[model samples]
Target: MERRNCVVTFLRVLLLVLMASVETTALYGVKLKKKEHRNAYATMMYMGTPRDYEFYVATRVLIKSLVKLQVDADLVVIASLDVPLRWVRALEEEDGAKVVRVENINNPYKGQRYFNKRFKLTLNKLYAWSLVDYERVVMLDADNLFLQKTDELFQCGQFCAVFINPCIFHTGLFVLQPSREVFKDMIHSLETGRENPDGADQGFMGVYFPDLLDQPMFHPPVNGSNLDGQYRLPMGYQMDASYYYLRLRWRVPCGPNSVITFPGALWLKPWYWWSWPVLPLGIQWHETRRQTLGYAAEMPIVIIQSIIFLGIIVMTHVARPGISKLCYRSSDKTTSLIHTALKFIAIWSILAAYLVPFAIIPRTIHPLLGWALYFLGSVALLSIAINSFLLPAIQVFVPLIGVFGSLLVMAYPWYPNGVVRALVVFGYAFCYAPIAWSSVVKVLARLHVSLEREQFLKLVESSAPSGFNKLF
Candidate 1:
């Protein structure tokens, strides 16, 4: 009886252990599924200015495209206290769209310099929102227009955050799964301004999610040879007016029939009204609000002034005989011309040298400083021109003299590359040459004469004292 009891007891103990193991395994699977489901909601955030009518129109187009894709999603519009709520209200009227207006928080670091504080505030808000119910969200700048539906982004799952590579992290386009941990980390990262602060969000992710660097979830999309990132999106998406019109030629037209987002770099926007023909009529009308009335009115006036000033300078030099005689008698024309030419060469050499450092040094910080120095040198040249024209005897030789001074100063023994050093020398010379030429021309033009032999003798004879013989 005792032996039978022992066998039965052993069997019961084994059965209990097996049951507990099965229950634990089932619980683990359930927990994993629950975690996966938490990241299922599709969401996108847009921050825009209240007065931006063009941006509003673009947002509508984006919403229409998203609806057409049949993806269940929400669009959140972030606005500040200064912006009217009507903008958000107008967007929410669209079917299946929700616009949330968040008040801008005061940040001193932002806008103290040339930085835009609004963007940083919106980023902070997005970080806070991540702690809420949504599983996944996309942060898009207000100017983004969707060419096609991007619902496949959800497939990247919780482990991956989708964004464009080779771009600044703050570029305002990214896909992330919402988590309290990430939210806390992002907040800390923003507060400290450190990429990987001790226990901060972005930094923590960089360390924990090192895999992200290699398996970046979304390589920026490509369609028919078109690249699709926030910046490189098709012409139908947000086209930067600065990069398009001012910086580069616009090869494609931006219009409504095709979707285009407008990021409000107003000073840099397309000034030509004709460029809008590629857009839908309604969108064209919307974009017109972005046109600066002051800039448009001033452009013609500015062109007229420039033309008049140039004509005055040219006519003054070409029309005066007395001026030519004075120049020929007082200054050695050959030496003056040679000096002018040498000054040109010297300025050009310096400019070339300045650009060499920019090309060879990978860090932008030093190059930016170099640009500031170049700009200051240009300003000095302008000052010399004004002084030479206004005060003829001021001996406006500073620019010519400064050329060699700058070259000697920039040629440090530390930079040993001959090509780089040569470029730097050329850059300084290039920059100073224009200033020197401008000053010389201004002085010559103010003297009031063309170098003609017949007109020179007539002017000298007329100026000779009464009854005095004129010397040829």
Candidate 2:
């Protein structure tokens, strides 16, 4: 009983922490002030080819956001040896950035060159510590956006970063003091293979600053008294955009933060116009580029995404039934195919029109279209499951409860304002909950049957004696 209670307590704590992390609100309220140190906001980029122009654009937008907010800091670009001289000149002269050329480090993990280039491009970022010109530097990834002024981060100590996991900090945005000694120590760690346990600079830095959380925080003299936990930077300093998908209720996209970092692959980047079709924040990124950088080329992306989106819709209508029938084995293939196709279209029509719009376009831009599509799509999606008889009635009822529950709140006769309108718009996502579950159940049922058959044949083969098996 004691052990069970301890386990429950641990689970509760873990659950609470995860829930807090998902909330797009500020966790800590520690006051911050800019220090007298030479503060710099730095980012790294390597232009291996013309395709690498995306990084250049990302760096420009980052600088523009910083400048727009009037953040008291110098912008530094840690460019690679491969970066074009013209780009370097542009960053320095045109963008008012200080460009520092650094060498690219080879991927420590074999066959991870793609992952390293896209995700863990932080090996060269270590060179920021060698920039003794800046007394203190806040290194941000080129993919980050400034929500507000963050010059006060300079007041923090040598090591300051947000928690990525339970014990490790994300290397996307971090504060550091530049010194040859610290740089050499990191180099030594790299040379000795003692730098990264997880084979990335993220883990490497965590190992380098093992006692970061336990360290005594820097307290400003103006505070008049020693205040505890002044060094701990709030999680709001670097908000992850992925949290948007977790809690559909807390709909403030930017949330309360000084910066929002989109930490993902090339396709997942917000600056990429092709990414606009998928990522909701891509619109804001594109707007920033258009207004600040005078970059407004989006026709190519619109054409491509339209083609892909329409292609998927066409495929869903014409080919989905045929594909779904392949999941099961039947002697009468024609009858099975016909039945599958009929049932699929029936259920798909129940929800496709409703949900597909939400999947395709962001709710902020077209709420009316999204709502219309939501109801239509729900009808299409339901027909596929209902005709197939894969989902239980409870699955349908739960989502209805969600829809009506929100509707009851929204239908309050006295109030009808922006908040209410926003609620009505966003709350429509819950209406498709039953369809999502039904789709999951349908897929799992087919998979279970396939798995069971395979297991049964294996059991039959094993149950027979060795001699009998050999005779057969």
Query: Model 1 — which ten-residue stretch has the worst lDDT?
Result: 27-36
Q: What's the residue-level lDDT of 354 in candidate 2? A: 42
What tens digits encode model 2's per-residue C-alpha lDDT throughout 195-305?
A: 466567776788888876566434343555444534333223455554332112111212355576787765668765334334445556666666677534333543455
* Overall lDDT per candidate, in order of appearance: 0.41, 0.58
The local lDDT score (0 to 100) that residue 57 gets in candidate 1 is 49
lDDT per residue for candidate 1 within 95-176, as digits (tens), equals 3455443444333344334455334444434433342455566555544444445554543434433222332122334456
Our model 1 lands, by Cα RMSD against the true structure, at 19.7
Q: What TM-score goes with each of the models?
A: 0.36, 0.54
